[model samples]
Structure formats: structure tokens, C-alpha cells
Target: MSGETPLPATDPRSSPTRRISIVHVRSGVHILPREMLGTSTFGVAMKLLKWLPTQVVDRFLLIMAKMMIGDTEKYGLKRPKVGPLELKNTTGKTPVLDVGALSLIRDERIKIVSEVESLTSDGARFVDGGEMAFHAVVFATGYKSNVPLWLKDAGGVLTAEGKPEEHPFPNGEKGIYFVGFSGKGLLGASVDAIKTALDVSARWTRLSETKDVVGL
Candidate 1:
């Protein structure tokens, strides 16, 4: 199993700039006991939490924040944060927020990165003295975003196959605007996008009013 062990954090389908298979262990997991969702382990905890119906995770987060070594609120954020759409820790294990950053816990097996090398789906090749595989390989590197999904603009059509719709998104028509493409956090992105849209709409409305005045 050592040789076939799953490669670390790099998503094979995500990157092509520099192919690397590093040994990565997950960095984040929440295992507070009072959690009702019971995300006691890892892996699926984050995913399952997304579908849960309570603020248990958030509560634990706040509690954990208080217990941490530094400025508690700054670790996650500082606000009177209360939201109905909550992630659940339905899994028996403590739900991990960022699976890519998940940490090792006693309950969960620590997955380490190993065999950081080029992926060679292609035929093996011989170097000056040794053999190397993979003429070219692709990797899937995960991304980070602070925003939630619903907040982000639907943008293109969401297809059944999860393929993005075929519409010129945020195209500058009579009224269209985009806030963030390479922005940070999923939630932030949505807020920014919406702000743009609103601003665009307001400008359009004002221009229309002026046009009506001239026509009158």
C-alpha cells in the first residue's frame, strides 16, 4: 500500500504549471464534544457538515476560539456571526472545515504525503542513466474561498452534469457587473459580485431617467 498510497494535497486534475506530488496531511478538523452534529472523525465531516441544519459547528468554533493560544476571534473572524445555513458534523468524527488543511487526530488515521514525483500515465522513458516516467502530467490543486455557494453569482447556467451554462457572464450589456473573479473567499466573492450588480443597475436607472427627461 505504500507505493500505491494516495498522493498528498495536489489535485491531479487541478494544476499543470509544476507537477508535484507532496506528502500532505489534512490541517483542519473540529472535534468539540458538545457538537450535536457529531462530527467526531474526519474526511467526510466537512462535506456532511455542509448539509447539516444547526449552528453546532459555529458554537464549537467560538468555544475553540476561546481556548486557543491567540486572539480568538481573529483566527476565524470577529463579528456577531449568526447564520441559519450551517454545516453539520453528522459524521461520527469531528468535522474538518478545510479538508485540504485537515490535521491529524487520534481518532482519524494520519494520511501523510509520500512519493512526491511526476505522475506518469505515459510510457516510461530512460534518462542518461536511469528511467523516468510521465512525459507530461496534470494536477488538481484545490482553491480557497471565504464565501459560501449561494452568495456567489449563479453566473453561467448550472447544468445537470455540473457543467457551467453557456452564457456570456457578467458581460457588459445595458446592465451587468462582476465584483470578483480571482477574489478571496466564496462569501466575499458573492458580496462583491452583488455589489457590482447593484451599482450597475443603479447607474443604468439613472441613465434611463436622464434619457426620459431629454425625450420629454
Candidate 2:
């Protein structure tokens, strides 16, 4: 946000026709269009990546990012520093692409603030001792799992942060099982649900047979 990129003032992309300004505050992020992810080419690349070495796959993603997002440096922004896979590994979720986000960001009507010192009813104060007044502020920061707060005991299978510790998808402990903990999204959740239902049904049938044999 602090760096200067010599863009022509006449550039229509950054036109200052509107008085409303949007301030984007964040650490570095990785951005890719949702449509790109759905492409057949991308899907094929993913399948091929599984057979390649990690180093090669990472370099391949780096090249793919440049091809998709263009040269971020040319805009005087150093964001999208982490690739998609790296971001997913660190955060446990993939980035959601907002349509036209890139264009909105590069507009002259928008400002980027990387650090904030404080916030008040009036506006936000930056770490650099600068302040700006705003009519409203919206926080788009993601959510955290609240499982730790309500789950009584997890038998060392879950972390204090409400995430599974034993495996990416938690192994069933006692009678408790977890679904949608794999960070693979809804499709992963659906698969987990089906597996859980089948396992529970099998256990129930065995219990019923045991009770019948005992005449209870």
C-alpha cells in the first residue's frame, strides 16, 4: 500500500468519479478466480501434480499463479505472496474468490492499509500513527471453530483450538465422531457423513443382535 507505481493519471481503471472510498486492510493473501479452479485444464493439472515431487508441484503452482494473476509487482503490490496450496496448509481453508475484487482493489477510490493500531467509533488508527475517518467498516476476516468451547472431552484427539490433532479428519473416540473437519469443503463433509452413517448403522445392528441373544 505504501509503495508507488507510476500509473497514468488518465487510466480509466483508476477513475476517481466516485467519492466513496474503500480501504482494504490485510496481510498478504493468495487470490485466484473460482472459475479458474473449475477449469478442465486446472483439474487435469491437479491430477498430474499428485504424481510429481513436492518441489516441482510448488514451482508449477508459482508459474500458474503468475499466468492467472499477472505481475502483481507491476501494480506496486506485493500481496498474493503465498500460493493457494500454501495458504490452505496454513489456514486449513482455501481462499474464496470474489468477482471483480482485483479491479475494485486497483481503483483510485480504494486504499490499502496493511496495519492498524486501533479502532474507535470515529475511524481506524494505523500502526504508522496515521488515522482515517470512515462512515462504516466491514470485517471480512474468517471464522474459527468453536468445538473446543462446547466439547467436554476429546481424549487428546482434538487441539485446544478446536481442530483435530490425531488426523486431518478426527478418528472416532468413544461415541463422538467429527465430520467436516478435514477442510476439504462440503464434498468432504458429505463423504464423511455417509461413512459415519454406515459405521453407526453397522454398530447398531451388532448391538441389537447381542441384546436379542441375551433376551434383554
Model 1, residue 11: C-alpha shift (Å): 17
Q: List, residue by residue over 19-114, the lDDT tens digit for candidate 2.
A: 544444355544444444557433644675679754466566556666876755444345555655555545554544536646656764445553
**Which pairs of residues have clashing backbones in candidate 2?**
none
List the candidate 2 regions with Cα displacement exceeding 4 Å.
Answer: 1-21, 37-46, 53-58, 73-82, 96-98, 148-159, 164-170, 184-191, 194-198, 201-216
* Cα lDDT listed for each candidate: 0.38, 0.58
Worst 10 residues of 1 by lDDT: 84-93
Q: Which ten residues in a row have the lowest lDDT in candidate 2?
A: 2-11
TM-score of each: 0.34, 0.66
Query: Candidate 2, residue 100: CA error in Å?
Result: 0.8
Superposed Cα deviation of residue 118, candidate 1 (Å): 3.9
